[model samples]
Target: MQSVSEEIKIRPIFNTQGVCVINSVLYTGYECTLFGTNSQNEIVEQLELESEIVKIFPVYDKVLISTITGKVYVYNPAERNNKLQCVFTNSVIKSIDLDGEAIVLGTADGSVILSDVQGYGETFNKKMDGMITLVKFISLSSIKRRYNSKNKLVAVGDAMGTVTLFNTTGEVVYREKNCHSGQIMFIGELGNKILSCGMDALLIEHSLESEMTIRNISENIDETIGACSLVGDRLFMCSKDLVITLSADLKIVAKKRLNIPDINGFDVFGECCVITTDEHDIVLASVVQDTLVVDKVLIGDNDEITDLLVMENMVVVGTNSRYIRTICKSDIERQNENGLIRNKAFSGELVKSNNEECVLSMCGSNKVFYTGSKDGIISKFEVVTGNIRDSVRAVKSVSAEAPITAMCLYQDLLITGTEYGIINGWKIGDTLELVFTASASSSEITGIVVNNKKIHCTSKTKEIIVVNLNGGMDSSISGHKKGMWSISEHCQMLLTGSSDKTARLWKGDINSTLQHNTSVVKTLLTERAITATSDGVLRVWNTTTYKELGAIRITEIKDERIWAIKRYAGTEYIVSAGPSIVIIKDSSWEVEKMKEQMQKEEYIAKQHAIIFMKKGEYVSAAVEYYKLNLERDLKDALKRITGEMDISPLMSVVLLDSYKFVKRVSKWARSPYLFTITQRILQTAIENRIEISAKEADDLSKTLLRTAELFNAAY
Candidate 1:
């Protein structure tokens, strides 16, 4: 299977925990490291910190990172010597927000401190009843213009589920006791309303005038609200497995299930939202016509895969969760070819066949599969045709005395090995009837295989127990120093992975030992022998020559282990699972060529745009820059076009709908230079009597005024 390496392309099929976006760059905090990726999902920087990161906030061009140890550090990515400089050290900081130069910190000890970034000391400090969970600065100007002098009000959410607003003098302006049944997850402002979501799965909008809830919604959201973000006027709330979008009136606009159950962090920029999962996967989604669409997923380890089975046209994956996901091979191919949008969900059917227990082993024939669970229950399911709510139907289930750890099918018999080293043989028919049972070893059985009317099984005893077909002990082979994890047979050749950090290939009495850097968790035998180790790497070896070919790093995260790897029969598709599910397809040269061609076209267009800009062709350059999403260059070209008297050249930038233009230039609100240039472009358009819809004109005017205020505060 040396050709498998050349023909196959590995892609994460399913989609970090702490993620935020600022100025188009995505920052994700994993462990004690902060990773920054650009819009194209390229790693821009990686900063290692002293402690586990708790929260990250964008402060002008710098990022303020708070740790679990109550230390705050400032990171300036553009600096020559990029380093984290400690700014403050106090009690554990649970939440943080910045307005102008003032930093508001909510501590786990129920203290809220208002300090400056310049280390000038705390301007105001106060203690509350419960541990502060969230703190945000909300502007009071919208409530009353005269209050603008003392406009900044601190919105605080505590562990007791209370929401409180305080002025600069620490006097409570508004307080709502027990606003939620659980700890608050988010607190922010939407016009004159204060929006807050909590672990109780409630999204409440409080009126600034009356200090009461204007609208509270719990419909369509059943899990804890992990995070919430604002895109334009829409409020997007992310729960365990769903993303719910609400309108300004707190009405449910759209809801989508991402199939990612453990969301750790989330943030939004423009129309795009980024989610980080507990497994370290980063999912980037966008709002398209009111629906949340997953654009790309940076897969991370979320669950430990227990078993893999290829049944019919589907690759069934059993994870640590109670469900088994069956991915259609055709769907994988179609998604790989047409890009992931053909099926909006971008996932497969989830079958909860094992009740609440984790699936340990799987065996199948044709469209029928049997799963063994940790609860010692065996469930048989048949894949049904057509659009059924349940993709698989349970035909029968049986309880074993011990947890089933390994299973295999031989002709009309199903053989299973259990946690107590008991080997069982059942006659397959209308009902699963036990035919024979024998003690294989004293330790837990890990693998079982039947060949030539003989049974070969490995267990925690570090020995391969051989038994006759009629429940009699034949002999035992000993070689491995530790318990074997997995075993497979192909044409009389046997491959076994063991906890001793070695995979041994045996043909007759002669065996070749393939040593790995870590414990071998899984092994597969095809044309080549593939072994998965605890070091998160797959080592390929030529079965015939027993020579190591190469290794693939399956998991990028540190200390992550590969738990399962299986190849689909008669196809070049392989599925590996650990933190995320990855689909490896063979004969994918066409896709690679297509990607290369697209990159070439983008490079050519960027070069042409640069040439046009140098030659003073502002309109032509603006068109190219806009198409390439080079926002900086596009804005510069638009500013230059405004200087000319011709209204047609200005059309290249100002002719679009106001919402699109506002979103495109929203990032520039932090830069005084770009902000002024944007203002000049808008002024020129109005002065030239450019025809624009009344709605567009109003939206543009409001966005620019808000941009002006933000620009002044940032500078």
Candidate 2:
């Protein structure tokens, strides 16, 4: 299986500064719960985030956060021993900003929410025209002729192309009439001009006085721009492909586009652009010969950088692993700067890749790429000339015994779905170790996609889970059951078309069997289907209306039930593969057996364990003895047992695990089998000089002596 970091893909850090931070909900990379390289360029206090930090805004002292599951958290970097103080509210925060407890949040319903984050104060909610994408205070404005100081002016951008400016003291000042063509990525105020950037490469310069959209920049750019910032007329805007700078009137000053395969987000600090990549590597860049030159790299231990922050000269990074990174901007910026690239761009390092699983999914640019594999490995490969680069480890292999089924890339983050019920994310970097691993559902994640709100995923249990991703890497599970599979936008809608012959759809996120409780919204039978096979074909069906979209004749069967159905380009040609046949479909689908056969074996093992537990107290003790160290020694031990007995490896694990949970065991005076085994273990321990409790060892020795005497008597 592929376990090398090079095999997996990672996104890039689009921005950075004097102070930067990364927030994650599910994992921490460098063995620290919360590790931050302080301004002193050393890892300081390690702390855990309250839930999962999806977005973090570094304020004066503390940081404001929006969680994946739609919660908000305010963390204070008081001292090394400061406790993580947080609060929860009912409203789901889509985006956030920290203004001295004046928490400004972009809500899900296209509202800009202002909360007094300092003390126990009420959160103020107000609606906007469209779903809010970003909310920011007009910190500093143009060479101010005269602008309100105390009465803060806030800029709110939304899903649509509109960006409105609201004053904290009172009414609207000026709204950009034609802000952007589509969704506005971000908006900010630079001097007197209003800066707005969006999905398309459009960044408009408008006058605060006239409210008129002036110079529309993106003139020569050829990629999607996600964010924009400015330092007195020198405009900084990020593109889907690179970071570009413009003059006051929208003239292209300089462009920094590192041919990164994937990018998450980016920040700018004092002549440096801290770009976080998909592999969790923070590339610190500086201006060198008219280009944004990369001078240093702070590699995150295989963490998917969900949100990047640069606050008050302090750096913070959050991961999907439920941890916040307070790293020093200098820690990453401390590297040798290379002049213009001459012959070889730094040494072309070649190393042998040690990944076990083969490739399963891949994404990235023409120069670099990242791949996710069966062995849980996330690796990165460089495109040297026209050949693929060697495998360099990025994210460590995961716990998924089955192959990684799906990979979705956004910015610098890679979201992976496996056959097991796990959706893990990893940032791309030099080392391949898991920085954050989250469980979307234990339903065997098969597919993952990112929309405006959350990262939508589908699992083997045929459930769609939508988790708000902006809340940092550790964002919570909000948008619960609405995904592409649900077929409908309603969270109540559900469907069952795969193996369970009679396709059933539900109205809630619950399993189909529990639909009776939530009301079965709709149901359709795959009536003409044959017995379930691994490679069987499947056709599309409607759950809400209970209608099969295509004809049943085309959804045919070969040797086995189809495990997966894939469509290419348009819906015309498709591919459905399973145990044997990879049936290319014209307009068809299939049903197949559940892939988790090991779960059944594990259940059987647990049953056997319970039986053994009831045998006697001594026998029960065996459970804990073996299971306590199961992950360490027991895994290989169980592997040996399965190899010897031809038993299911899953069963062996469950049986051994029973030993770990064995609280008590009993030895009846009439049970000879127990006495024999106990005596043999005691004798072995004594011979190997391993310690055994005095009283227990004595009892075992006495039992053995008595048995020996009995044998002598019988002879």
Give the top-scoring candidate (TM-score): 1
Superposed on all Cα atoms, model 2 deviates from the true structure by an RMSD in Å of: 21.4
Candidate number with greatest lDDT: 1
Model 2 scores a C-alpha lDDT of 0.45
Q: After superposition, how far is residue 580 of candidate 2 from its true place, in Å?
A: 31
Per-model TM-score versus the true fold? 0.61, 0.40
Residues forming the 10-long window of minimal summed lDDT in candidate 1 = 337-346
Over 562-600, each residue of candidate 2 has an lDDT whose tens digit, in order, gives: 232222123222222221112122232222122235456
The local distance difference test score of model 1 is: 0.73
Instruction: Flag regions of model 2 displaced more than 4 Å.
Output: 1-19, 22-51, 98-103, 120-124, 139-150, 214-216, 231-233, 262-264, 269-272, 277-281, 288-290, 298-715
